[model samples]
Every structure is written in structure tokens, then in C-alpha cells.
Target: MQAILQSSDTELDIVRALRENCERPFEDAHAMPPAVYTSEAFLALERRDVFRTEWLCVGRASALANCGDYLSAQIDDQPVFVLRDASGALRAFSNVCLHRMSVLLEGRGNVRRIVCPYHAWNYTLDGSLAAAPLMDRQPGFCKEQYKLPAVRCETWQGWIYVTLNEHAPAVESHLSELSKLIEPYGMGDYVETFHEEHVWDTNWKILAENFMESYHLPMLHRATVGPHSRLEEMECPPGSPAFNYHWITKEASLPIGNAHPTNTRLEGHWRRTTALLAIYPTHLVTLTPGYFWYLILQPQGVGRVHIRFGGGLAPEFVDDPQAAGYMATLKTLLDEVNAEDRRGVEAVFRGVHAPLAKPGHLSPLERPNYDFARYLAGRLGAT
Candidate 1:
């Protein structure tokens, strides 16, 4: 682990600035300008300055557990292919074929060679161009020069992340504080159970802000999550590093009494707690007692976003029928909650475009939201 920088006076100054301005109380519910969520210029700036520069989670390491396994994905519209080489080490490369810019792979599968259907070009799992149908007759064609371009890839806590910018600092550097915050959860020991993906009509920020606070539980998710969880039990403590926020929410125990609503359980089999971690610009991880769920938000456009939910269980619980069943139940509950939020977020998205719409202030409970907005503003060069 790299040492936390404490020697440079400048480092302390940066920390001080964050401690001060970043936590300032949000004044009005309208402090965030509506333009930030609906403007094309702002979205373009984020695509370049935020999405392209950060280490974004691409998939779970377990996705490529076997030597020949591979998965093709897009991060912020940039094509990428991840594979486990013959040596068993994982690598990521731009999926675009060098010869004619064709995508090398379309979906997930195991393959000995990535053969481009467009031109019969083939490359090994390690990204070396092994064969080109007519390269021998083509002038200026060199095997060494046709290898797929590589991207910066790293694995931490059993998750794989890739960065588009070659010059960006190591992933660990950017995730330093976040790593420490999540280390206690034993995330590396978790094995995936199921994966879910969906597209939302609202801006990604709206979804993020919704997760940062539980104040809406009493209203939005009363049947799904509200009765089980309490606002007082969801604590968002201070001292988050720049670009991230951390919180702990006591899991709602099954409700009791005939007075409790129908269709909602009054008693669950076990009590669970959730440690929530939000990494700015688009990653959300919920560390539960039995499993963890990670949400990766991909911005498709100013008003569209793709959310991928990956759920995992501890290695010991992977084969436990009860644990696996519970995880499935949890996934269903989360899906219901997300569905409710989607409706409201979409409404907000449309309302924000109205002529009467304006920036909103932050609630004391929403300090994290304010912190995130500040971080976004800084990264978008709006600060």
C-alpha cells in the first residue's frame, strides 16, 4: 500500500479545503442548477473529464476466472475487452480491431483467439495479432504493429477496473481512502450469485442523490424498504475523502404486529446491516452481512443511464441453500426499491426542464450529496 501523503504542507492544504468547503451546509433545495442534469454541454464535459479519466469498475474478477474466459464491454461508449491470458493474469484492451476499427468481440464467452468477423483478422487472448488472412500480400502490414491497444487494468477486492487515460495515476491512488473504508467488509471473499442490468430515463446523478439519503424512505419505498429501515438508523458520518461518501444503515428488522401492513414481512429470518459506499461519477456498493451488491451507473446520454447490479455472496455461503435463497430475496427487494425510485427520478428529470425549475439546496442529512455535487463541479471545471 502506498503511504498516505502526510509530509507535504500542500497536501494538508488540500485536505483542509475539502474539510471546509466540501462539507458546507446545503442552503436551498435549489442550489443545484437544473442545467447540470439536462445540459448537453455539461454531459460532454463529464464524458471527457470524469468518465474517461477515472478507474471505472468494468466487471467482477470472477467473470474471467478461467484462463481462456473473456468478456466484452463498453465503458462510457469506449469498447473494451477483458480476458484471462494463458498465464492466468487478467488483461484489458481496446476492443477495436487495428486493421479496420471493427469490434473484436461482441459478448461474453471463452475463446482461444479473438477473430474479427469483419476482416478475418485474428489475435490471441493476450492481444497479439497471430494471423491476418491477407497480410502477407498487403504492403506496410506488420504483425508487431497490429496488436490490440491495451488499457490500464487492475483488480482490487475481487473487482476489475479499467481506465482509458494512460497517464492517470494508479487505480489504488485514486481509491486509496475508499479501499480502507471497505476493507473490513471482506469483499474479496464474496462470490457472485446473480447479475441484473437495466436502463433508466433519469440522469445518473438523480439516482446517485437518491441513494445518498434515506429521508425519502417513509414516502417512496414505504412498502418495500421504508417499514424495515428507519431514517435515524441510517447514519452518514462525516470525513469522506474527496470524490466519495460512506454510510452505514441498520437493516430494517421484519416488522411485527397485525397493524403492520400486508404483503410486507413482519419478521425476516435474520438481521442484517448494510455498509454503503459511493464512489463519485458512478459506482455504488452495498456491503450487507451476508452478501454485497454493486451498482455501476453508465451514462448513455443527458437523460439516459444504464445501471448494472452485480450481487455476490461470501465463499462459505455460496453453496448454502438458505444463504443463496436469501440473496435472491434481497435482490428482489432491491429491484422493487429501484423501480419506485425510477418513477420519481423520471418525474424530477422532466420537472427540472421546466421554466420554473431551479437549483436546490442541500439538507443537513444530504451533506454527502453536496459533497458529491462539489466534486462533480470540480471535475467538470464548473468550480
Candidate 2:
């Protein structure tokens, strides 16, 4: 790992503390030590054991419906791009050009080929080297052998996931139970309507922990979702090896849409409930009756995270004549809710840096939070 991302003595001590806490029972477990949020060495370890090895969700396949659509991102700080090839297959490759190591693309766009601006080297949509100016003059240089290295890519329920680890389990296998739990939501058919990326001034885990539980809703989101939150009705079941989930039931509301018309198949409290899930490392999603939204997190450092925020309406709402207008209203509402979360979580990040910062007791409502700590500990090889 680079020195910029390495850990310090204080950080190593925090990792030791986390290992001790992981040995305790869930009921006796406290929150993760504050240094875990601000330690560069700890972040380096997480990048190796968690982000680089897990099936990190990049975006939805629907975002690249047409051939040649591509999106670029830094997976564990490694430049990579996912694109649809001419044959309609989704593929991922190192965004680095094989020749000079310059990034081949930026952001998302429709492209027939990836051209490196640094040296004019180009690659096909499938990452095979297409053209290398004057390379024919270089003796014994083989164009075929210079193709960009492939990254492991998979899709589950319309979402695209990529893992840098060749040995990682398939995305579907990892989310098998989660798939059945959310089968009624028809997420495979959900159409993404909006996406926005933001760089937040907070540790990735801090933001993810906040996302997994609604305990802070009544306080942090007091002006937005706080009013409608049914904290007492929240239920967080134990997590499986691949994921953890919690449920909260509440009456339906508008602008965000209510019980999806085609979703009448769900029964009783399920009709009024939402499932919030954290898929291991960093894919966070909320499955509801009418719509679904997710946060795909990428840790930039100990104190910063990159987030891809997106969501979509159910089939019924997507078919509605006023779909666009309704979506606009919902986007505004969700943006406000996200802004509220950012402000609150950023403050927590600042607090985590204090010398006296210590792990506090968790509440029953923080069951998912407790589960998260265990997952992290296990990934970090904590006994």
C-alpha cells in the first residue's frame, strides 16, 4: 500500500481494540473504536480485505442498456471502467492504458472505442487493443498481448457488480437469500430514473452505519423523514454471511408514491414496510413498496467517501402518465433527506478525531450497526 494510505501506531491499537470487541457477544458489543474512522493504516487494510475483495456494486445494468455505454470509477483506488460491448455483454477492465498507464476514459458516456489521450493508443469496447500508432515498428511487440486486463464482473437483479478478486463468490450466490427476501419487490425490473455522485467529507463506514439503522432518523432527519419514522416498529434480524437487513413499517405517503399498484401481492405489514440492506462491504439499499434507492460507497481515504446515489420507481409508477413529474418531486424530497444525512454524519466524522473519542454502547435499534462491526472485524482478520 502507498505510504499516504498506511496506518499509524494509534491506528494499529484501534484495530487491536476492534479484535477484542469482536470476541464479545452481540448484546455486549460496543460501537467500533473511533480510530477506525480516521486511521490511514486501517483504511489501507480495509481496502485490501474488504473493498478490493468484495463484490462491490458499481451501478445498474439498465444504465448501460445500449451497446457501447460505459462508466468509470476507482474501485479501491484502482481506476476501472464497466461497459457494454457490441454483442450486448457487460464487461469491466482496468481503465489504465496498457502502453503508458494513462486512464483511458472519464465519467460515463457512449463510445465506440476507448482512446488514450496521452499517447493516442486505442482499445475496442471489449478492451482489446485496437490501434497503437507506430507500434508496428517496434520489433517483437505483439498487439494481441497488450489488451487491457479484465476485472471480474457480474449482475444480480439489474445491478452491476465488479470484484478485483478472482476468487470472490459470484454476486448471485452471495445475495441468494437476499434475492428471495426481496423477490416481491421486483427489483430486477425497477427502472433507474436518476443518479448523482458526491464526495462526502465523512468516513465510508460512518456513512454506511448511519444508513443501516434508522435510530438517528428521529433526530438527524427530524425535518424530513424523521416525522414519519416508526422507530418502535423497527426490527433488525441477524445478518447472513453475505448481507444484513432491517425492517421498518410505516403508513404510505405521496410524492414518493405509496403501495405500488402491481405490488398488491405483498401482505399485511409487508405492504407498509421497507427493507434496508447492507450487502457486506459497501452496497446499501432500501427496498420499499413503491420505489428503491441505493448508495454505492467507495472509500477515498480514512475521512472521505465517494457515493453513487440512485433510485427508481416500480413498474406501476413507471407506467403512470405523470411519472416524470412524480419522479421530480421525489428527487427533490430525497435530495433534502440526503443533505440532512451528510450534515449529521460529517459532524460525527469530526468528533471521531477527538483524543477522548471512545466507543459507546449501542441501542437495540442499532442491531444492524452491531452486525456491521462484526463484518468489518472478520474482514480485517480480527479474532
Candidate 3:
């Protein structure tokens, strides 16, 4: 096993400084300036130095379960496509036609050839230039020179990751600690059950930081998550690898006693061993007995984020299509909880924009969010 990279004394000092500066009283949460939420300049910098260089989860491997299956998506404004070719090898591409710079596929489907709509230029599922409308008419047209541009794609624990840079290192090299962190739960065996897209009117970082801490659950999601999950019971395992942390919370268990008076069938469903794990940048994997939810947050712009929530169920449940309905019901319940969070975050965004705001202190209970912010600041070359 490779040795985990230890944080140097300088890194520890930085952490201490961040903890001291960011952690303040509850009233200070609103003190954080609006720039963190609304600065276009900061967003552009993050896109170039942070998102561009990081390994980002784009889709799930199961999305391409059969031969010739493919999905097209945009990662941080860069167009990319994921496909399982005829030979069953998963591949990713720039999703742009080599001929005239047009997108080859708009959505997901099974295709023997990816034909560009702007022209009849077609490429094989493997991204080879298979056909062109009238290449012979163009004297200098060369099939080899016009093949689709390929991107670096890899799969880990059933999730698909793509990087825009051709020469970027392998995904494993960057996700040094992720494998061990997820191994305990047998993540590879879980099946996806629910998936949805939500638009958040805040920076992707804000959403990420919000998730790293359970401090807000009591206030923001009092009805759903608060009664069951408590900050005191939330466990942040020590000696966790940098940029990634492992946590196990018992509060995720369903409510009991008086809390159960108005409990519905859904409460019994959610009570089943709910586990949450987040990989850096924008992937959050949460598991429960009834379903597995994988969230991928894509930054659309400075003030907008596209959130994809994919749910996977146990294989036994998936064998019967009817079971998917149960999963859908769970998703609906979650949608309500998420809607509450969305409104709260939007309110925070508005408050941060006020001229009275400043960088706030971090609470000891909010160590996870503070750590995450420090990680982001380090990656974006911020102090």
C-alpha cells in the first residue's frame, strides 16, 4: 500500500490560521463577503486553475451499460462525450466535430455512428472518423486528420471521470485516498436508483462547503434531517487524507419515540443506514438501504450550478421495474428537503452581497467546512 501523504507543518499552520480566522460565532456566518459568492473574476480564476486541473466525476459507468451506448455532457463549459464502443471499451471525446467545430451529440442514446447535425460527418462509437458527407469533393480532405478529438476518461468505483487536458495524470494518481475511504462500504456493489437535476443559485463551492458540515441541518432542514441527525453524533475520523475526509453520522438513522408519531412509510425507508461520502471538486455519494444517491455538481457560471442526483438501488430491487417506483417516491421526498436547502442557500447568497459583509470566523463544529474552504483556497492559490 502506498503511504498517505502527511501534511507538513506549514500546512498545519495554514489550517490553524484558517480555523482561527474563519470560525466565529453564529452571527458571523453572514459576515462573509459577497465576492466568494458573486465575483466573476474569482469564478474565472477557479475555472482555469482549479476545475480545469482537477479530476471531475462526469457520469456513472452504468449509464453506458450496453454496447454503443453514449452520453454527452459539458464539464465546466468544455463539451465532452462518454461512449461504450462496439468492442465494449469506454471512451470519451471532445464532442466536437473535427470538420466545423459543431457538437456531435446533444444527449444520450445508442448509436453506431455519431453523426454531426451541422453536416453529415460521422464518427464511429470509438471516435474514429467513419464517414463524411462529401469528403471526396474536397480535394484535401483527410479522414485521419478529421477524427474526433479524444479526452482522458477513466472509471473508478463505477463512476466515470473525464479531464479536459490530454496529458493530465491518471485519475487514481489524483484520487490517492478515495479508494480506501469508499472501500469499507462496498460502493462498487451499489446500484443507482434515483437521478434528478437541480439548479442552485450559488457558486458550486458554496454548495460543497454547505454539505461538509452538519451544523445547518438543525436550522435549515429541521423537519427532515434535523430531528434525526445531530452535530454531536457526527463523526469525523482522524488522520484522514488531505482534500478528502471520512465521516459517519448516526443521526442519519430514522427518528424514534415521539418523533415517530407522524412518521410515514418514507421515514421507515430513510432510516436504513444512511451513509454520506464526498470526493473532492463535485461528487457526493450517499447510501441508504432503499437507494444510493450520487450527486455531481457542475459549475454553469459564476452564480449558477447544475446538480445531477443519480440514485442506484440494490440489484434485487432493480430486477423488477416496479421497484423503481418506490425509488421515485424517495426521490420526491428528497426533492422537498433539497428545495428547502435551496431556498436557504439563495437567501445566504443575497445576504453575502450586502456591503456590511466580511470574511467570517469558522466555528469549531464547522471544521469540515473550514477544511474544505482551505482546500479550495489552496487549490485556487488563495491565502
Candidate 4:
């Protein structure tokens, strides 16, 4: 009894600390408490209130152009899939076999139908149970009554989002203001050329906070992007109810980071500007004039994270002769930057577990992190 009480008290302390941090003025803001990242009870609260109810992004809508192209993902513990049905409409459904309750799909692919490998109980492209072999002997068995339960799915800009909660607000309206802000970039028209998933040894929020701020770019990523970053030029504005963003304008070292030579959509400094958008819960995007990349994060217990990572070229650069070269260069730089972030975030996670570790003061460049702390605290009912 005493041990559990101690744990609960510790969690409450962290929550209060977070609320206090969010209330502080920007000049006195602080990073999140270490306990916020290490508590299993807090993760359960987030899974119920945040992950289950939020509009979680699965991937780019362009990835499922064909009638039967499907992508499978696990939201916290619930397995789900997003696909384009025969009617050429986007759809999402619970990816579980009704018979033995096995997961139906594994990864991204084109399929004429979804078949359960366990018992050969198959479903059509629309998720209607097409057949149930060896079930003729079962009494009162009706296949029509066993269609896969549909999940709420929507598209905002060009990205696909699925939510377990049917009553969650529509993704488009929730992010409409953000859409208008970046409309000139034509994000909806970008083409995804590469995608890969990896698990990292850090709390999900750690990686998210890393993406939210560029304060560590000078020292942590000095070998790659650090030299080009100017701390004084970055703009960290107040975030909206659903998202936070920062801007960095630079004479990009990588040709693809700046506007391509043929590009005319962006004039003047817009050509060299980069937008780092942190969509609530766990979507982060690095949008430049020539290309874009994003991370869709989910917690793997309290100690690690599952990252859905991908990127691609802007419409202007997609079909050009140098498209392949640009793709290669972007992938290489992204890989290098990712390596740096992994090291930095993993170290922070390690440090958080130390006995004397605590939340530190935030730099002005870390305004996005401050906003993110408020978002997390608010969702967890701490604010």
C-alpha cells in the first residue's frame, strides 16, 4: 500500500510540475519533468485519453492510389489498416480476424482481398467476410453479420489519419488553420518516394521533443546540419490548439533543402525557409520548398518508441530529370540527421532515469517544446 501511494504521489508531483512549467512565461519556461517520461501509469492514462481518442496519422494518402492498396499499423495496442476500397474510397477497419481474432495484414501492399492465414477465413476488398471454410457445421452462422468493424478514417491535406474513437473531431477542421498557413508549399501535392519504420530506445515524447526544437543543432548535429543553423534567425511562435510550429531560414547546404531551380511557387526567402510542424499527439513534419519528411510516433511501453518514418519530393521536383539524384541526396541527409537525433534522444532518456536528473530551463529556440509540454499536460488532465 505504501509503495503504490508513493508512486501515485510521485506521478501527481510530476503532473503539477508540468502544469507549472506550462504556466511560466517563455523567458522562464522549463523542460518536462523526467518522471513524465518514465511512469507506466501515466502512459496508460495517455493511451486511453490521448492515443485512443486522437486522430492518429497512418501515412500519406498517395501511398494507396490503387483500388486495393492497403497499409497496416498498430495504434498503441489496437491493430488497424487503411486501404482504398473497390469504390476508390479511402477506408480503415479493425485488422482482426473475427474467427480466432488474428491480425489480418502485416505491412504495406496491394491485395485483391484480406485473408486470415490461420483458418483461411477470407474477406473481400471492402472487408466483408467472403468465406468461412469448414464452418458449415456451425449453427446459426451468418457471414453477412460478420463484416470487419469499420474505423473512422479521414484525409487532411494529403495524409491519412485513423482514430479508434468515432466522435473525435474531423482532422481537416482541426488542422485547417495549419493548412492555410502552409498552403503556398502545396504539401498536398508532394509525392512520397521512400518510407521505412524503426524502433528507437527512447520514450516517444523524447524523440518528439527533439524534433520540436533546434536548440541542440549546433552542438549535437554539428557534423551535419549544425553549421548552417543560425539560432538568432529561427522563429518560434505560439502554437495553435492542435499544433505547434517553428521556422528556420537558411542557405541550405543540401540542394534539395532549398527550392529547386525550376521552382516558382515560392519567391524570395521562402526558397530557403524550412517549416518544422509538430502536430498534436505525435506527428512531426520537416517541410522545405524542395522536399518534406515526417515522423509518426507511438510509444512501445514506457521505454521505447515505434516510429513510422518517410519523406518525399515536392511536386515541382517529382518528375524532373534530377529527381532520382535529389531523392538519393535527401535520403542520405535524412539518415545522417536521424542518426544524430537517435543518439541525442536516447542519451536524454538515459539521463532521465538518473536519481538527480530533473527538468531544466528551456532556451528561446525551444518554444515548441514548451508548447508541446502544455499539450501533453492538458491531454493528461494535468492542466
Candidate whose lDDT is highest: 4
Write down the lDDT of every candidate, Cα atoms only.
Answer: 0.72, 0.85, 0.66, 0.89
Rank by lDDT, highest first: 4, 2, 1, 3
RMSD of each: 8.7, 2.5, 8.2, 1.7
Q: In what order do the candidates fall by TM-score, top score first?
A: 4, 2, 1, 3
lDDT by residue for model 1 over 177-211, one digit each (tens)? 77776665567767777776889999988888777
| Candidate closer to the true structure by TM-score (higher is better), 3 or 4 | 4
The global Cα lDDT (0 to 1) of model 4 is 0.89
Worst ten in a row by lDDT for model 2: 1-10
lDDT of 4 at 79: 97
Best by TM-score: 4
Native-to-model Cα distance after best TM-score fit, residue 45 in candidate 1, in Å = 1.1
The TM-scores, one per candidate, come to 0.84, 0.94, 0.81, 0.96
What is the C-alpha lDDT profile of model 2 across 145-254, one tens digit per residue?
A: 87888999999999999988888778898899999998877788878888889999999999999998889999999998888887788888888878889987777666
**Candidate 4, RMSD to the unseen true structure:** 1.7
Model 2 regions more than 4 Å off: 1-12, 255-257
Clashing pairs in 2: 6-41, 7-41
Q: lDDT of model 3 at residue 122?
A: 91
